[model samples]
Target: MVRSTAPLLALCACLPDPLGRCQTNTDCERGPAGSFCAENVCQGPPRGSIEALPARFFARSETVHVRTIVDRSHGEPAVHVLLGSGAVAAAREPDGAFGADLPLRFAPAGSEGPVPFAVEVKDDLGHLTLLPGSIQIDDAPPRVSVDLASIPSPAAVRGSSVPLRVVVQDLTPVTLVWTAGGAQGAAMQQPDGSFIAAIDTSKAPAGAPSLDVAFTATDAVGNASAAHASIPLTRLKFVTRHDQPIASIVVSDVIWAIAQSEIWILHRDGTSLTKGSTDATPVAEAATDGHHVFFARSDDKVCRMGSDGSIQLCCGPFTPLTGGPILLGSNPIVSTRHTATTSSRLVAVLDSNGICNQMSWLTTVDFAAAMPAVGVDGIVYSGASQAIVAAKFDGSVWTGGHPTSETPSYRGQAAIQGNSVLVSTTSATIDTFASVPLNSDAPTPTTVQAAVAGTVISSPTLAEDGTVTIATNDKRIVALKTDGNIRWNATLLDNATASPTHGAGGLVYVGTAGGEIIALSGDDGSAIWSQKVGAPVRGPLAPGCDGLLYAATDASVVALVIDAAGLADSDWPRAGHDIRGSGDARRPLRSASGACLE
Candidate 1:
């Protein structure tokens, strides 16, 4: 029995020890259906194998839905699945399968790269299974932003350079898309993720409206973002400032200006006509008749210079005219005074040699003031009694006086058409526009008065169709029909200080104190186009023979090509357009239909 017991013990020892203390798998026996001996201990099948499902590549600020299957074979049902800082409860199926819908949200401050995931499975004994493996977590996308504060002003002038700036946050490439004045192009990105696009408006189409700029950013992962801005373009083709303020401007073959009390001529292309100062300082506005420039000097002398800057004529010692001299066939008709304190004014028609050939005494009671208008029949001027007076060139008084009830404070020069004399008057409380018949015998002239609401400060421009265009102090431009009826009124950008210029195709051009040149329709007074020229326009706009419109600002002269038809050909050349100061240039100077001929 001892021997048999000894052999049995030896056989039991040779077999597997039930306590299961083994150094290798060869010393241990498989215990259960889903159990295995590991590290000399019997363990259940891995708590669960977590298999990550497909997911979309997300951005840093976006959330991703993680659909994973947790398999629990020998271990108990999985309670939850953990991925990064996000977790989800595992739903156990009847087939012992565990599935979890995990929402993994990557925080801005979270780690980027591969993320480790773990699953918690509980056995029947409350033991937990933690499975760990690396899954890629790519939530990094290039950041992009627009710097609107650094953007250029919405208003830009033509032929000017506009700068654009953009800011990007990543190393991703960037591009600038720009469309200005019907022009389109693309710009490359800089090293610092910033893009700078300089747009030159001179290269834009003739009538290009505004500038539209956009920026596009693309990340390394194909992510994209965009931003946009707009800028309104102006009609100013070019601007060149002078050392001194520009007092007046006249356009002929060359552009002339009174700056620094001297005459400066500029070519059509904005180049200097003369290498240096052309003439002596002038006391008043300058006038050009396409060949010779006439000006009044500080010494009360009226002088004429050739277009090439050669002095032609200088007549002086006589009383200086209140307004500039009126040129009629190479002669100057001026309102002069024999003595400094003389109450009566004389209308002197001077010869080409500056010698007064004819003189007519104007009847006066109070302050002698008049802007004379010369026509084919006679010379018409406003008398001191606010009446219309007429005289012939031979100093013969034709119409002594045609009195009106209201005071005639003529703001702009008078305009004559056919048998009618059109004048704009502004009193203390009323703005009156009158169309008076030219009758020497009629004691009371037939006057048709068109009352305006605001003060009329600019001269009335008469069209060939007998329509009238005028600018008022209230920043308004109005058109009047033949019978003095209101056609249309449009608001101006600022105070309309300069006279409205009538262009071809029934268009009117007006300048404002706000540095804007506005074009209005002659029929309805609707705004056609507006350009901010960057300086106050104080002088009249002259339509050139070319398609360009010339204007005088505080510091420079600007040329703009506003219309395709170009400026019309009119006998009226400078301000107060004609020699009669009629301001109407719709016809030739000798035409009987409203022609101011002497």
Candidate 2:
């Protein structure tokens, strides 16, 4: 009984008590490396407290190195960087601080403002803590732009204060610099993110035939942009004609000026030769075949005179015409209003021995007020119906169907090239330059159409290469290929009312309502030169063989000498300078000498 009791006592002593040993963290202080007393057991230190150095700042394409100090009383802590949803482990430094490189680009692309980040610390016992922080992002640089208005005129006179305007755009304050004559100028900013600067040409260098102006614009972020322009300077020669506005001008061996009811001839030296008068009526316009000048009186009487102002022949009083007595192979084709009530008629008055032989007419509907363009095979004109009608000299006529179905309003005069006819039309529903084949038998001619942005206000001038030049009411001069493709365009300061004329050396001349004549390169539409005539020009430019450009303004006739070598002794004997009113003089007229009359 004693031996059994002793074994029971030993077993009872070996059994442990039911009460736990630890209740708080302080009770198990001397345990493992990261041990802490919790839940009646020793454990590691609580997740270390993370403190970031220099909490937050802005970054632009810069690396943000985050240094954090983690406090873990019981053991060292593992540190990491939380950028958005991604985590990057940090390296511990010799000073006991944790660091991680956070590139600003790590943020979302094109992101701005504060980017959230955190320094996280974890202990060996799996406890975690986070330190919240942020960084502002602004890495984009400011943009800059520059523009120059009216830098190059066709011709700028020396000592003239040519007006120049410069415009700049930038989000922040911009520094603008411009050089005119080593003289720098600054621009003032406007509320609409634009700056304006004016350049005075009077301060340019002496004897400078050309002026080169350079401009630079710098933004707040050190971004810069630049631009430049060139201007040509020349001397001007002016010729005055009648006191009243010169209605029309034609240059040959002599310059002819039509005003009121008389035609006066002026030599190159601006001397008046002789004056001829229409039979008590105003003439529409005159034409020349380099031998004789012919014009139609308002009373339907067609008169002919020599280039020297000698009266040749006068025949007509037949049918009343709206405009033109265009000479086709010495025969006159007039756009006549048959009776007081009829639409219109294109009458061909046949002449032999300077006498009217037989008069034949082509009846038309909706005939335009302008003259018909004469081709080798036929005559083309815009009908009142918005259709283009071509009347062959053999009495056969072909019509191009209406270009637009909505309304038919035609602008400018028709131009005939071989079997093709070019015309401009603008209506509420259509504004286009159409090339129609005159020989086509289709009821509605299939035309190559080029859309125009503005109302064409002048007759189309056909070039030697079949290109067509037309001026719009919006001051734009456009050139088109025979296939209706745009060749080039030039914008003027004011509306261009005069038709463009071709000259020697691939040059195209156009006159503006602002009294300015501009010469453009036919190849690329670049400005070759420009001149201000000081009066409104409403007539086409006539190129003389003397290398001079003859144009009539509101008050006088201007003969501009552009290229001396280009003068070819050609005669501008008529308004359009040719039988077809083509405004192209391909052959030199024998009547004029090689010497410049002016």
After TM-score superposition, what is the CA distance of residue 519 in candidate 2 from its true location, in Å?
A: 1.3
lDDT per residue for candidate 2 within 1-598, as digits (tens), equals 4355888888854543233246665555545444556557555554443454444334445677788877653456778888755677899988888888876566765444567778778776566667787776543333433443465556675445555555664444568777777767876666765656565655555345577777787755345677776666653545665766666765556776766676677776566777777554546366656566667776677777776666677766646666656665556666654364433666666666767654465666445555565544444444344555555555323343222332455544565554444555553122333344544542443343444434445656666676767777777877877566788888889887566776656677778888888878878888877777888885666666544567788767777656532322223322354422433333333335544322
Estimate the TM-score for candidate 2: 0.51
RMSD of 1: 10.1
lDDT for 363 (candidate 1): 38
Best candidate (score: TM-score):
1
Whole-model lDDT values for every prediction: 0.58, 0.60
Clashing pairs in 1: 418-594
Report the error of model 2 at residue 83, Å.
83
What 10-residue stretch in candidate 2 is worst by lDDT? 565-574
| lDDT for each residue of candidate 1 in 187-253, tens digit (9 for 90 to 100) | 5577775766677766655445865665565654355666676656766667877777776676666
Candidate 1 wrong stretches, greater than 4 Å: 1-208, 211-234, 275-285, 336-343, 349-369, 376-385, 394-409, 428-439, 442-456, 565-575, 578-598
